[model samples]
Target: MKITSIIIALSFISACRGLNMTRLRPYDLTAELMFIFEDIDQNGIMTVFEFETVFDRYDSNVDGRVTRSVYTTYICKSDPVQYELSHYLFDEYDVDGDHFLDYHDYDNFYNKMDTSADGLVVKTEFVNYWVLLFQKYENSDIHPMSTLCR
Candidate 1:
């Protein structure tokens, strides 16, 4: 069936090594963000290990969670420095509405990336999420995600 072929192709792509981000057509900004965060080894892959590494770095309290302060700091450091830049990025990632980005929020983000519900996000799933995000931006005039992506 066509579904089977798609699955096989996705698996093959995920299994392949390294990601040439610059070569991704249409310029995927979400993938660029993930590449900055989840590609710890810089091998063009977003494994759980890499994901955790980035999160742990942001979890500055050493409490295994990320607070708004920490998340904002990370974004400010990565993104172009701007007035209240960290505030906007922190607001975006604070999913619990608790005014903080905790382990639960982190889990939610990873869950979003784990499209197959397999508790792990392969390269395909990671890129797919970025693609979807990119599309959402393309369809809208607002540039909130654009600021984050940039």
Candidate 2:
């Protein structure tokens, strides 16, 4: 579930100075979160606050908590190519390595998709996820779901 590309990018940082690493791009919020996410390694260090009451704030279903089906449904309904993403998600989200996707599996998947340093997937991150869900889509002219994604 770690965006392998981004994780590898983190590993390549040559700078280890205190708060002044070469990876620190002054205009790059994404890099900063990557640093914290790498440090936590469990997604705990970057989590910013407590918002358990805000259902679908992260978990869109308002089902009290996020589950795999809810998230996958979101992805499927939004991905530019729905069919392809269904299989892609199945491959990535089966966290037990058992090939069965579930809530626990999705916990890891959802966290990885939360690209922001804020620890929560606000609308913007959802859009980012869609764009990333199919990197090839970036070249297409599809209009992203602005109201939904962000």
Q: What is the TM-score of each predicted model, taking all chains together?
A: 0.57, 0.36
- Candidate 2, residues 1-150, lDDT tens digits: the string is 569977876755522211222222232354344334333334433232322221233367444444545545665565423422343445666667664544566566658757664556554454455445455332333232212221
The C-alpha local distance difference test score for the whole of candidate 2 amounts to 0.44
Query: How well does candidate 1 match the true structure, expressed as C-alpha RMSD?
Result: 14.1
lDDT of 1 by residue, 20-131 (tens): 2323345455466656666767676566666777778887768776766556656657643321334544555578788767766767777888888887777777778767
Q: Which candidate comes out best when scored by lDDT?
A: 1
- lDDT of all predictions: 0.60, 0.44
Per-residue error for 78 in candidate 2, Å, reads 12
TM-score of 1: 0.57
